[model samples]
Target: MERTLHLRLTCGLLASAARLTPVPFLDDFLGDRARRLMVDKTLSAHGRRFPSKQVAPLYADPHGCLYGCLLSAVKLLLFPVKKVLTWLFALRYLTRDLSDAVLLGRALDGWLEAGRLADATDPPARLQEASLLRSAFDNAVAGTDMQLLQGLLMKALRGVSGLPKAAWHAVRRLRRGGAGADPTEGLSQADDDAMKRGTAKLGAALETPEARAFLEAFDARLAENVRILEARHASG
Candidate 1:
């Protein structure tokens, strides 16, 4: 989903009022490595027909964990030594793929809602909500970006095979329902002090009336999202 952001900056003040989108193209979240794992899979054998180049994907549905397990078992039988890593990759990705998509969409929605309360919005956020923003969020809630979610998870666990201690820590984080010190702590290592300073600068802009309201509500909103994800995991 998308919306045109119109802004006129003049002499340090937003003349036409700055309508900024804080998040980037969002599709940027999933890099190439994970995308390949989630969307593409090479078949071990020919199709039900004779040998052919056409190989359908192993796991296309995010919520299909059982299916992923079965696929993994099948791959294991055909090529134990050569495909262990790829099998693990698919299994790990599909485990929380669907649920994580909802979680990510919720995060993005929270960002916009949080941002709307940041300052006085151009058209006034109190008026009916922005249509484009609503569409974007609606799609997000529908789990439209499974590849992005799966790819990101794959990236976070990237070197786990070589680092047993880190792998255990990652497991602990997941088993604790992701509610520890840093709910999204895995991503924090990617942030540098310079990035922190840049973020602080950007955060300073939230001083306006629209955005100010979100500060008070932010923590509660975040907690709610965590609970939602945890609850979904528990039920499954």
Candidate 2:
């Protein structure tokens, strides 16, 4: 998932949020697509299975993996702020293509997770920074956020209290229908199929010589970024 991220850097600074680690143990909140939505496929039905063979090539050829980017972006956004920033910094800084803009769409949920963006001393600048961050995120990933939103709505419905009998029945129906299969997602079969094709194609494309060269470059860039991060964050 990290390898195939559709990275776009909005600015040049110590940006971060999405982390590179295993998902926290989510309860049954995740459905059958648990594995897929676990990493960076919240709304995507593609199940974000980055088989070891397919990882390098997809990173090498970003063009062949827009769906992968979207999946990665969407999945990354669903996490808490720290993890999201980690993922963003990694993708935005490590990729060879610095000209391409990386969307911080995941940060739009800053309101949901206050302090995700560090607050300035002055209230005005703090508000302005948060607003800008949200607007940027809205521009990039709002379309995909709908699926995440729907899943959230389902969770909300399930969490609803003191609802009327009719409303409770409606919520029950929704759960029994599509929500039961994958509680954390609402992607249709078509969306799932598209992800399948995208994942397979990118995986296959990475096998080429061109992709191998790109992978070599990417590795160097990633190592360089890690060194920079260590230098900046390490204890004095």
Go through the candidates in order and give each one's C-alpha lDDT. Answer: 0.30, 0.31
The model with the greatest lDDT is 2
TM-scores, one per candidate: 0.22, 0.26
Q: Could you tell me which residue pairs clash in candidate 1?
A: 117-210, 117-211, 118-210, 118-211, 118-212, 119-210, 119-211, 120-210
Cα lDDT tens digits, model 2, 99-164, are 111222122222224442233225454434434433333333322323322222223223223222
Evaluate model 2: give its lDDT: 0.31
State model 1's lDDT. Answer: 0.30
Q: Which stretches of candidate 2 lie over 4 Å from their true place?
A: 1-186
Q: What is the lDDT of residue 161 in candidate 2?
A: 33
Off by over 4 Å in 1: 1-114, 117-138, 141-160, 163-167, 173-180, 183-236
Residue-pair clashes per prediction, in order, are: 8, 19
